[model samples]
Target: TPLRKWEDVERTVSLAAKELPVTDMHTHLFSADFKEQLLWGVDELLIYHYLTAEYFRYSELSYDDFWKYSKQQQAELIWQELFVKRSPVSEAASGVLTAFRRLGLDTSSRDINIYREAWKNRTASEQIDKVLAAARVKEVVMTNDPLDRSEREVWLHQGNTDTRFLGALRIDALLLNWTVASAELAAMGYQVEGEWNDGVSGEVRRFLKEWSAKVGALYIAASLPGDVRFGGRDHLTAMLEEAVIPVCLELGLPLGLMIGVRRQVNPSLKLAGDMSMKADLQLLEAVAVSHPDLQLLITVLARENQHELTVLSRKFRNITLFGCWWFLHTESMIQELTRFRTELLGFSYIPQHSDCRVLEQLINKWEHSRTVISEVLVSKYKRVYESGWLLSEEDIVRDLNEWFGGRFAVVRQNAAKTKVR
Candidate 1:
């Protein structure tokens, strides 16, 4: 797959997945080049770019241009202009399970293989068929926000666009955003509805519940940018309060938070100057205390010139943090990252630059480790915990005790046990 047109490249990977583990190692899989690869075998596609591309793309234009166009025109000219659309959920989910089985990459819970074998005693095809039949995909998928030209201009006027682009070039960016969202949802059997505004919390919840029932969405991706936190937007809180679980029930998509880090901020600086790290911790603690079953994924970039990726790896827990790059310069960092997240992290997408051999080697290794962790450990943990045998609170305490070399137990016991019955 030489660097050719985007669609061809995407096609090559998508088709390749049928035979082997097709890993598109890129900073962002939304590029046309990336999309071609996505269709074939994009099992475990890892996105590593700022989810804010859509915002910047649309914000580059003026509001006059933005509102001047109809929704269809806006969708086409702005949102549709960038990135490959996502594969449908049903198709994508099926493709992933099918490919995994075909490749004998059964990283599902250990019990999965046992149960599967005990039940079917059938051929591989039969096994995959059974898995597909029982498959319940809860994808928390979301698109980057693409602002219209007018919107971009407002941001620009407010010093937000921060980059330059031509007229309606911003619109092209918007189109790309919508294209990715629309295509992904359509593939998964859902039509794109406009964003919810002016709806009361109850109204919003009802809408999401109905929509979830219709689309069978298990979890939807809720992208909340850092700006919102600064401005007290509280999108995550609102979603949780209003329509979170209902939407989760309707679509079966658990609420996955797509947290964004500003690209302009140096990675090292972001880490070093991270007074807000505790804020993220507080957010997680809040979610854990409130939405016990919620899944929080904090997405950040590992772009070439940023910071100490390996050092940054030890930061979060129970959160899926992503570090992506466009070239292979970050191999060492990626390897070190695997050590940090061998158990905790889900994926690390580092697309190759000029060295396909290097990328192939690195990606093969990444895919292997990712498979083991995601399939083996994650599945086991979930199944055992969900079986209602071990209390989650106790499990957390035990893990924390182990983490603290058993010191935490004495402190926790004295604090909690001494306070009450």
Candidate 2:
């Protein structure tokens, strides 16, 4: 698997078991630059030096190639299905009608007659069909929002290629980015409760009820702000409560909330390229959306150190928290990375970091911790804890010792303070 053209298999295996042995087919296989090229369909010779080496019969596919091919194939399939299914606009019209009724608007004969006439006159369904047909069907998730005249055009063109392919790969879970309030999300039938400014009100509970009926599995992204009235934090607890209502009552829906994080504005790091770490931490702590069954993603950019990574790892369970570091060839790492970004960030907005090492390390550590807890501890405990399954006093000491490795311990309360000249 390591030598297979695509590293995804190797990565996937690694994620499945934290102790899985990993061997690189070639050193170049780990190179970010080469991986990028491989993604763009690079040649074998460029991928492996042995192909260019004298007297060596080069095997065509490496692990990376197979993975890349798999991606392309899956993307094409999703495109095909999306085109074939052609989700009807009548669903949307029906939803709007229902909403009108909830909002106290009459759905009587007069209103129905007017609506019927408008529906007949409007070519909304036909327009949606046309947009899907015209989509270019690129096999990549847009790095940024793309310009498309019609909403349907954007969905067809920009649907999560990465997520679709990963799901096809049969990973445990996939993270996705979305704003519940966005029109696309609404079309997907995610109900919006009370206004964000109003905190989590009865309306939010109603929205979750509607959403749960439709989506058997749910992930909600959320964040908190310092301001009590309007920020995500105020409503997040309510949101989670809403999610569990149906799940607990045996409504047949399994719900998860990937409490999203948003960076707070900070000016101290003016030259530090976005010093929003503290703000992100605040959001994580204030509205801790930790649950044993649910997968929570903590999405934040690293500030070029392991400090933030260590702190986050110590907190939160069922968390796929992403820092700036990761193993490109590990599935668990990739999955965690995606969870942090998509599941958590889908609701929360954390800016991307440019540094590779910090990002990569974040990924590795997150994968390591998640694998240990989910694969091992969660089953053993079979019950949730406010602060994760108990770590022994010895375990705590060991972790602390590791944290302060080789750093001097205090000498009997430091006897007396010495004045510095």
Query: Which number leads on TM-score?
Result: 1
Instruction: Give the CA lDDT, 0 to 100, for residue 373 in model 2.
Output: 26
TM-score of 2: 0.28
Task: Put down candidate 2 lDDT per residue, 197-249, tens digits, no spaces.
Answer: 33333443444444333222122233232222212543344434443332323
Give lDDT per model, in order: 0.32, 0.28
TM-score of each: 0.33, 0.28
RMSD of 1: 19.5
Candidate 1 lDDT over residue span 1-421, tens digit each = 1323434433333332222322221111121121222111221111112111232333556545644755335433322233224221221122333434434555353232332344344443343233222221111111212232223233233322111111101111111244453344344344444563434445445545554333223234443333333213544455455555444433333344433333324342221222112113344445544543343333333232123332233443323343332221233444444344434432321111111111112233333333332233334345544554443334433332232123212222222222212
The true-versus-predicted C-alpha distance at residue 215 of model 1, in Å, is: 4.7
lDDT of 2 at 15: 39
